[model samples]
Every structure is written in structure tokens, then in C-alpha cells.
Target: MAGFLELIDNTLGTHFHTPVYDPQTGRKKILRVIELASKQHNEGTTRAPNRSWAAGNNEGISFSPKIDGKPVLIGGKETNFVHKSRFQDFLKGLKAAVEKGDLDKEIKAALDGDAAPRASTSSSSGTRSGRNPLSNVRSSIGRSLGNGKSLEEAEATARANPKFDAAHIDQVVAEAKANAK
Candidate 1:
């Protein structure tokens, strides 16, 4: 349940509606909200985004289901990713159990959580530090080109210097030429 709920929590943001041509009539313009996931609902359009199901991580684990700040264990191991159809079957089992009040004792125990507080985890990726590596390389290449050196001369000079990577020099040189164009 935590996996399902966290999927919703991670995808929230504000967005502006983009006007697209109505495919049905092809005459009227309608506001369309492009979705990467269960994200911002702009004005009126509501639709589910198309996605594919796959594994949880590189460790080859199955479904990782957590409830009430704890991991669910299956056969003395934390549940890992499984195929979607299999997971749906497991959900059906859960539904049946809930209908018969089979998990009442376990649910009560879970609600009465541990006395110790859990430390929250945080991630620091997926965002830029506002610095671009392109600016540095482009500036140096531009200065070399401005010094009246030929392409071959620049290539040879870079090859002699251990600081410049051989494989990337060609790309940077090509980009420098493209910028000139």
C-alpha cells in the first residue's frame, strides 16, 4: 500500500494547459493535460497515463509492500516485485481475507505502532545544481579557435595534452564548428 500511495505522492506538480486540436471533430481546440503519471489535474481533462509494469530494482526482489511504516514479510523475507497479474491475484487474496476479518488482530497490532520514532529518509538526486559542463568546454574550444589555429593543429595539441580526453575531443571540436555555423 505504501508503494501505491508513494507513486501518487511523487507525481504532484502545477502545470499550464496546452491547447490541442480535437481529434474527433478536427475543427475545435481543446485543452489537453499531458501526463507523465498521476499528476496535476489542470482544468477538466481526466485520464490515466499509459505505462508498463516491470521489476522493482536490480537486486531481483519481488513486490515491496509496506503498511504502517513497516515492510510486509513473505516467507521470512521482505516482499519484492512480481508480475502485475500475480500482484493482482495477491490483492484479491487480501480482499477475501479482509471480508472475513482474518487480519483484524494483525491490523490492530499495526495501528498500535512501536513507541520509537522512525527516522525519515530523503533523496537528493533528479535536480540540477545550476552549473553546466558544456559552458566550460565550449569556452575553452572557442578561445583556441579564436587564436588562429587550424583544426588539425588544435587536434594535435589536444592529443599531446593528457588533460583532454581523446574520444570526447572530436565531439567537442564538431560542436564548436557547429556553433560557428
Candidate 2:
């Protein structure tokens, strides 16, 4: 069982870039599994980070467990497989199961628990709401700087233009340099 858990952990770790087991207990951690699932959910779609591995869908991953001589499909809400808040409890339960050699029962219980909360759609909504307010300022400044203008031209313009403040620029530069280290 420990070997099986280690195999799963290594397989998952390669794909997810995160640890997937409780080292002390030699068990697969449920929270880590949930995190991997979440990453799979968000990787690859129109999502900015584009990490959805199984298409653009957010449907929770499925697991099959043999409990009491019956094979059960653990998915949807009963799995609570994607809920972030329940991660710690899930990990604890899984560790306990591994220690007792009843992984099958623990897996079944997780799969049969209350449905996890639906994944949020805020990323899509935020992207569509409009460009960030700061973006407008950046664009305006970029335009004012003009295409292919030399640094000398910019400096000359700043010196000749009343609106350009060299003192403010120096202060900003100084502050940024101070904070860089």
C-alpha cells in the first residue's frame, strides 16, 4: 500500500509540481490531491494562466474505490474532491486510513461526503468587466511618449514642458532603487 501511494505521489508530483503525500504517514494527502485537481481544472482554457488539463470544464475528477466488496464511483458533490476549505480534514482522514490499512473505506467516505462548492467563475467575469483602470493611464503615457522617440527627445521635452516634473521622477527613481534590494 505504501508503495502504491508512493507511485501515485511521484506520478502526480511530476505533473502537478507539488507534493502529494504525508511523508510521516506514507499516505496520499487528500488536500494535495484536491490542489492537483484544481490546477487541472484551471490549466488550459481561456483562463489567463491557462492550466486546465482536462479541457475547459471544472467537473471534479473521479476516483473508484472498493468498499465492503462493492466498487463505488466517487465524484460530484459526494466526493467533495475539489473543495479547498475541507483539504486539511481530508488529508487527516486519509492519513488515518493509510495507518489503519483501510484506505478503501476512507476513500469511499470522501467520495460519499457532501458535495464540494462549485468552482468560481470570477476569472471570466473579471476579464470581461473591462480593462483595468491603471491600464488606461499606462496606455496614455505610452502614447504620449510616441513611437521610436529617442531618450534625448524625451528628456528635452521634459525639461521644456512645465507639466513634466524632474524632481518627482528623481524621487520615484530613488525610492525604487532603495526598495530594489
Task: Kindly report which residue stretches of model 2 are placed more than 4 angstroms away from their true locations once superposed.
Answer: 1-78, 81-83, 105-181
Candidate 1's TM-score? 0.27
For model 1, state the Cα shift of residue 155 in Å: 36
Clashing pairs in 1: 62-80, 62-81, 63-79, 63-80, 63-81
Best by TM-score: 1
Please give, for residues 48-162, the per-residue lDDT of candidate 1 as tens digits.
2322122344523244333444433333333445453354455455445544555443333333432223342211211112323344344456656667787667666656655
TM-score of 2: 0.19
Query: What TM-scores do the predictions have?
Result: 0.27, 0.19
Model 2: per-residue Cα lDDT over 1-181, one tens digit each: 5677555545545658644434333224443443444444445322323221122134433222232322332332232243434434544564455556555444544444312232433443212125542333333334445554544443444445443345643443344345547
